[model samples]
Target: MNLIAVYTTLIVVLLIWIGARRNPLMALVEIGREMLRSYKFILIIVGMFSVLALNKYELQIERKMHLAADYTSFVFGLEGHFVRHVQELFYAPWLTPVIVFFYIFMLQSVLAASLGIYLLDKNRVLLYATCYTIILTYAIAIPFYLYFPVNEVWSYVPAGVKFTMLEVFPRFEQEYRPLSGLNNCFPSLHTAISVSMALLAFRSGNRRWMVISGISAVVIVFGIFYLGIHWLTDMLGGTLLAVVSTTVAVKLAKLTLRSGEDRLRVRSRATHTR
Candidate 1:
């Protein structure tokens, strides 16, 4: 058995046990019922995934567009060199673990939010909101990635600054890029999604989850910069995109809920008349 798989299973089991302390089986049954009732939620997720997968293939179309190297360079100007120095100051063997862990955690926020908020807290609305925000981040970021190819700071290494984060996790970096796809650095989807996760977590009533996701978001914002993966302007763009995406997602969710309620009310009235 894979140790990580076994460990994850045990943790989930423990949570289920506690969540349904009086009757674990009944708790699972109730969860099943809820899932059946919320089947549309699953469809929503499927739709989002479909869009992301399409985005990957669509990136080939992006190559025809000109690189915004001059524009991206103008974005940082002298500040890029200054931040590079700041990044170097923190580069050490000791800091590698936290940086790498947080970097991965930032990417995994969607999974964490789904499990943490939906399963642990049992709030589907918050869960969907969190998920949609991440989805929307990708939706909005894709166009920029297609047209505005801002090279990752690391690409500028020998000229301006060293690529600090990748240096620390060279093997992991080498392995991750094939799957992650390079040349999509503008607006930092990592930053946007992490921020959205933090926002959703905080809005959720669960203070513990909020604190954890909030901390993760802050670390990721700093981490991307420290790692030399994003320009400071990219962080700003990501943040703004997050806010817009979350706002739109929440509105659309409310509209969907309202539409469902209206349909249900009409059916109930018709049945009673019958």
Candidate 2:
């Protein structure tokens, strides 16, 4: 079996083991539940790996579908127009990575909040919403990556322009290069994930967190464009995905709750009668 298949099997086995520890019947149910919760994340990770594998093994496929040249050129042109303005406004030598780090950390924070709420009494509404949003974002993003794979503008911009910006934020540019990829720029995952966290904060009744997330999203969106990591269109796509994913997650969570509640009621009655 391929690595994908192997990994999928391992995940399934792990879930089963986790479920069985609870009780055989409960374990079976939990396996299904966990699969529903986690399948989207798995698929997204798989899609990324598949892209990497294909690039490694299939040059022809990469050449045919590659949007690197066009996307990079477009972003370069856009950045050229706004680069100076952005630098004047927010291009601090030390603040760029701090902002980026906070953006990533917010994702973890949102995940923790969602999990905490679920553990505190199983708020299916929140649980479903969070998982569904994450899955939906992955689902939408994978297709965009396949169809409109774009490299970061840093890959192809003129050396003169690159060096000028690098001078202002040398450390920021260097630190960003290792973590940010050239491909996967059509729909900015940063924006998508940021919006996801913001929406989650809103849904979970953390108004303060929502405000912080909103501000962070705005900053990250600016950072992405100003840094030439993504185009404006990519940010728009991320926003759309965030909205759609959050909506779907809320709906799915509601359905799951209804089903779970109905099952529990029936089980309780049966136990009483016995």
Candidate 3:
């Protein structure tokens, strides 16, 4: 695995341990059992990862399309060097690495740990709802990425924002740019996914998970602008998307799971009568 993968895996494992108070291996075994016991669980997991994989493919297609309409000017117009001001206000040599770490590593760690933590706590409803939330997040965001192309704040020179990410990950453009397009700045997924995960965790009834996810979300959101990667408008758009996605995903998960329970209840009654 690459250094990024290794670092994220370590962070995820640590988060799962702290939140669930169990070895991640044991939690994985339980997760596997849960998946085996319910096809719905398996399907939701598959669907969630499928959307993530599709997002990677979408980045490739976006690069090939050479999308010509840069809305960076429009976004900068609305938010007028907000990211630069943030960097100027908060920038520090010591703080940059901390912000960059959260910006890069913590988001994925919290997301991965959310799954293990939910399963270990036997919170099936929240687990399934998270999957749906992820699916909805990408489904909604991808269209904006494809058509409403907005460049990163630092990339628009007029914004006067420096790409602070390069301080820590000097090879960011070489290594990470392929995974993320320069122009996929609107409705920052970093904000949406992290905040949405925290929103779902609040309903999980696992206080530890709630605390962990909550702090991670807040830090990741702040890290966006501090890293000079996102605009104020992007963060605002992402927050709105987070609220809407989690709200809809929770309702849909309850409706879908409740119907499945009803079917199982009917089956149980028919078997007992026979």
Candidate 4:
């Protein structure tokens, strides 16, 4: 199989394994049923996918614009050799693959499975909140990616961090670089998304999902540094973004669902009168 196929299959398997804990087979069926039944649910799913598409388009725009600007120096100036020290302090040949696995696969896997698990639990509020968090996170981060560019820590020689991701996924640049730009390193989306998912999982009240997402977030955050991909400032900014996105998304989701409920009640009353 090709790289994308392999990644997708693995992610699907992981999602099933997690979702299976709570009748996720029914949840899978329910996702379809709900989408067909509720325009609001369908719209939320569309909005989620639309933001992802926008993210891809934004990458293309960034490339065509050729924003040769590099803020790596500013990041390095703020935090000198932090990533290098972290790597040097904990560099292990055996640990590389484990970290790379989480970096490459676990982030996206947990994200996808979170949606499925939410559906399985029948928690529409958290599901909508998760989708909204994703939309908001990308919406805010894309601007920085376009305007304020920062290279990866390893790419910046002054940082003295080695790109450990290369150790395992040597063809990462050739395979994955198309999806992720080399210079899009200001606020680590991996950090933000993983952390935001974990925050939402905690709110989901699913003990299993909470543990899974929490571990995924912590490991991914550490992996970014261990893999020599993101700087300290990037992680800090990402954490802040996660907080803002999650808070706003939760409120927005509640309001949107409440409004939908009110409209449904009004329609019911109208039907009864008729």
Candidate 5:
């Protein structure tokens, strides 16, 4: 992934969102100004990268743990019966293009859902919460990645089953493996992030985004499964992670708000007493 393109696109999305309410040129300048003023926004980016960097180092340890552990049976046995049907349905020749599209576009969907709420709906609380939820997911997942480095389902194909994300997207391995460790497949972060964005969109009171995000999240779940990148259990793990992270993010935002309010209340009392 070209990180620059990803962020540049996010910024453009932000500009477009702001443009809806103001002059397009003014919206662009205002977004630039807001980026400069919003230390929290910068900090959120910093926090996400910090966790990601830590992941590379931690994955080394996880790799060692992977060599020492045998978790394939544990994970595969728990995979639901419907997972096979899902794989069969998704692996169809005609659906190959759709699966590939969803695999790559899932992150953009997340950006749209979360940033749309912030930029269009003007819900800073929900924005902060969404960022926090994303980071919290990383924090939670890294530990699992470290201890339980389950390989992708592609490595453990059942009799008569096939895995095609690699076959279809020939460059995927060369491109994706460099950035991500091979064994970080226990709980799918893509699924978790997508699901969390959907949840937040619903909570954001924007019906349009809610529908869009909800549908995108479901597609992403199937995309991961059909691509043989994750098992049914990974999606379940991701869903649970999303719920936990969203709850934590909401609490974090509320706590920050409460603390700010308390400081203001203290100042008011101090001024009156003086």
Candidate 6:
């Protein structure tokens, strides 16, 4: 089963448990409300995955890198001009991978918002913020991917600079190898997702976790460049995407809340008049 099916099943089970114990009607109503509110986010994610899948079939088209090669190269030159040093301060194989894994997993901000929804019984703000962030990031990224398709500098790094473990990692090689095509490296999804998680952590009032995540994000950003998985320009692009996405998400959340409040006030006044 796909992720949608799995998540739907889990939600159904939770609703069933809620119905069995306290109030079935209220549980159904609550679930319906949440589904409606989050529908846009679900659609965006599905659309992104569909685009990625379809791109896989057009292998010949992807191989050309005609989409955004020159623009990406220019941006990369600007980033490379600022590189001060290439130091390997932290080189633990186990540690880097583990940190990277956790950072990626944290991008599932929906799960965090869901927890807030369950505990506080009102997390529309968090839900809206998370959804908006995801949607905005991909929306902004799609054009850049087209205009500046970049194969990471790491793809052609000097043999001596290549990290040993990364060079040998089959899965990583398969995903990023330039020969296989699909190399849009101007913006690092890793950095965008990491920054998104850090923002969510902060908004959720988990300052301690936010600080830790912030530090981890910085490490991952550096690690990706150091490992040659991304160009310095790619990291900058990722940072820009994250900032734009977060800003847009916040504005959207505020608008949603304001609209909700206006509706509630109108209803209250109508009831009072009656």
The candidate that wins on lDDT is 3
Of 1 and 4, the candidate ahead on TM-score is: 4
State the displacement of the C-alpha of residue 214, model 3, in Å, after optimal TM-score superposition: 1.4
lDDT of 4 by residue, 1-274 (tens): 2775688656755665664465545667878877876788778888889989988888889878887777888879989989999999999999999999888788888888877877766677787888999989999999999999999888888788899888898899988888888888878999999999999877766666778889989999999999999999999999999999999998887887786452321112222221
In model 2, how large is the Cα lDDT of residue 8?
A: 44
Local accuracy of candidate 2 as per-residue lDDT tens digits, 99-174? 5554434444444443443323233465556666666676677665656666654455461223233544456445
lDDT of each: 0.62, 0.54, 0.83, 0.83, 0.67, 0.54
Question: Sort by TM-score, best first: what order?
Answer: 3, 4, 5, 1, 6, 2
Candidate 3 local lDDT, 1-274, one digit each (tens): 2999999999999989988888987778988897778788888888889999988998777778887777888887887977888889988899889888888899888888888887776666677778899999998999899899998888888999888889898998998898888889889999999999999877765677778889889989999998888889889999999999999987777766786442221112223221
For candidate 1, lDDT tens digit of each residue in 62-85?
545544434556556745565587
Q: Superposing every Cα of model 2 onto the true structure, what RMSD results?
A: 10.1
Clashes of 3: 0
RMSD of 1: 7.6
Q: What TM-score do all the candidates reach, one by one?
A: 0.76, 0.60, 0.92, 0.90, 0.79, 0.63
Q: Write the per-residue lDDT of candidate 6 for residues 105-223, one digit (tens) a residue.
A: 33343334233332233445555666677667766765566666666554444312443335344454554343234366668876886777566546654344446557657766776
C-alpha lDDT (0 to 100) for residue 66 of candidate 6: 44
Residue 51, candidate 6: how far off, in angstroms? 7.7
Model 3 ranges off by over 4 Å: 63-66, 259-274
Q: Candidate 5: global Cα-lDDT?
A: 0.67
Give one clash count per candidate, in the order shown.
Answer: 0, 0, 0, 0, 0, 3
Residue pairs that clash (backbone atoms under 3 angstroms), model 3 = none
Cα deviation at 102, candidate 4, in Å, is 0.3
Which candidate would rank higher by TM-score, 5 or 6?
5
Off by over 4 Å in 2: 1-70, 74-80, 158-180, 260-274
Judged by whole-model lDDT over C-alpha atoms, candidate 1 comes out at 0.62
Consecutive 10-residue window with the lowest summed lDDT within model 6: 265-274
Candidate 1 steric clashes: 0
